[model samples]
Target: MNDSKPTPSFWKTPFGIGATVIAVAASIYLYIEHRNHLLALLPYAFLAACPLMHLFMHRGHGHGAHGHGQRDDTPKRD
Candidate 1:
């Protein structure tokens, strides 16, 4: 029974820690530097999110709790 677990990846190494810190710092710096530019896109971002949110939340929607995926004899919506 080969039960050996896989080795830890990048995040577990010292170099990875440094890289993560640099990435976070760069992100914060860029956001602060271009805060106005990012803010200008908020409305478009909100519009884009509507359809995405609807698509995810509406999965298996008509199928409810007990009657999921089973079709009804009558062509009527429950």
Candidate 2:
């Protein structure tokens, strides 16, 4: 007699199923009620702050890929 149970796929898992249900419900509610607010602010907010956000995003990496102290071979100038 077979005793093993079948394995569950992604949405069959508890967290996955719960998250899917929540997302669908939230989307339906938003579309039925708050869609105008979501639509109105999203594009303007994205456009206004995107460049400043990008500029700051590039920082904190600090000098080159090999750290600030180490130098790799690149043919020394003579």
TM-scores for the candidates: 0.45, 0.43
Write one digit per residue (lDDT tens) for candidate 2, span 1-78: 999989889889999999999999998999789988989888998897989897888786443557666876665454
lDDT of each: 0.85, 0.83
Report each candidate's C-alpha RMSD, comma-separated, in the order given. Answer: 7.8, 9.6
Please tell me which predicted candidate would have the highest TM-score against the true structure: 1
Residue 7, model 2: Cα distance from true site in angstroms: 8.6
Worst 10 residues of 1 by lDDT: 60-69
**C-alpha-based local distance difference test score of model 2:** 0.83
At residue 58, candidate 1 shows an lDDT of 90
Candidate 2 displacement at residue 20 in angstroms:
1.1
* Deviating ranges (above 4 Å) for candidate 2: 1-11, 44-64, 67-78
